[model samples]
Target: MPLHSLNHFKSVFIYDIFIQPADQNYLTARFLRVIGMHQDFFWHAQQTLEKLFKAGLVLNGVSVKSKSHELTKLLPIYEETLGSDAFNSFDKPKKLKAELWSDTSVKDFVTKISALGSADARYGLVGYQSSKDDLFKLDQLVFKLRQRTMGLDWVIGEDFRAEENLQHFNGKTYREFIEQNPTEQIRHLSIPYQELKSIGENTQDLFHAWNFEFQRKSSDIDKIAPGAIAPELAFSLSRIDALLQNIEAFDGFDKEFVPEGFKWLLDNVKVSSHWKKMIETYLSESKK
Candidate 1:
């Protein structure tokens, strides 16, 4: 089978496995056990073979048996593409620079970003100060363009003091600390609870029709509660707000100070409705 045919299920399974870590070798065994093959070694083997074929791995023109080696091979590609370490070490910085420079005429970059098969793949730096530099670059580009147009002293002021405070607040660089521990990074990236709640309330109003089920009945108490908002929905919206705030702060100086790269970043900021729906479904199902 062509790799493209396997795209949908492969991505879904890989994401579940990555976010909810399980022993790869034991996956076949656990699956077999669930299907009532715990005591039947032969049945276990057969089922494993079937799974391997379904997963698109073949050997000698036959579906390969699920062995440790074959399973390990699938592991690295996913880790490289979807893992936090992979994003922090390789993809994020490159993406940040690319998006900043892409500006308005960055369709290719947008398409590439859209191809990323992860929920958290939209912006390079979510809540960190490193992202500010890209914003600064955009501001400079916008300022320069305005200067050329108006022929005036239109210089954007640099926020060096704020940048320095972010840099030296702790003993180490923010990226270094974030890379060292992702959970901590998430905590550091999080907005205040009140702010997140306010956003949820605001989004609930903007998407009022979408909240119909939650508002329909007084007996549907659980549905109307603040916790009823899907966790991923809340998180994603908060992230978007954070990115917007960063953009606004950077653009506060003047429209002319907008970085040439801001267009690229905006172009690549799309998150598909299908993916968002999937996240919402996952949250609802998990809550149940």
Candidate 2:
């Protein structure tokens, strides 16, 4: 049998080309927000949500303007194209307040970030205003879009195995049923909160180290290579006493920046064999 297929448009992610950039932006946005970099946060938040909306549009077979930044325009277009399947929001005026994830508030957010078509509102060039709430509501909208737009089909990789049984019915193959009814396989995508927290702390350290130069603090803005971050776990366990216990319990990988195994560093990582042996011997002394 061929691979199992879910033809529906559901909100899930595995290797979404759209999501990779969005993830980077998401990480950056949260970092900026934590560091009191509110202006840049607005811009990155707008970028993140805009990409998500575009992802929804593209996933649903809807055409998107490649160079549009107007969330007001993009959000509406994405909804209208998806139609009833779009999960569009309507306004509620007489309520006590617009709830956190309400349709009214989401649209309100899209409006606030919509000054993209005609001018660089991100820099306040067009005399428009934005607030921190823009990000809060945008986060809500991101969640909504994930559930409505992502389908389980995304998780199906090239190495995915097909089902043994093909249940054909209703004048349609199994793929047809799944494609039409995406909610059957609904899911959502997310990132680790702890990682975002670390990025913020590291960014602050880098900022202070370089005298708070927002621009050109390093060669690449996205790929920040800060020397140190807070809450160093390797040292957090009072290792002077627990050193031997921690060694045996080690994860067999360096957790400083991100997880990487000693084996890979031994083979593919660039370094002289002499240095590698020196470090290996140094670590071996811990066993004594």
* Index of the highest-lDDT prediction: 2
Instruction: Residues 135-233, candidate 1: write the lDDT tens digits.
Output: 233223222211111101111111111133234334343334333443331111112242243324443343442355557433333333454355545
Clashing residue pairs for model 2: 7-179, 8-179, 10-149, 10-150, 10-151, 11-150, 11-151, 12-150
What residue runs in model 2 are displaced by over 4 Å at the alpha carbon? 1-15, 65-67, 87-105, 116-119, 123-132, 151-206, 209-288
Report residue 22 deviation for candidate 2 (angstroms): 1.5
- Which ten-residue region of model 1 has the weakest summed lDDT? 147-156
How many clashing pairs per prediction, in order?
Answer: 10, 8
Model number with the top TM-score: 2
- On the 0 to 100 scale, the lDDT of residue 288 in model 1 is 60
Query: TM-scores across all candidates?
Result: 0.21, 0.48
Q: Candidate 2 on 76-96: residue-level lDDT in tens?
A: 787676565554553343532
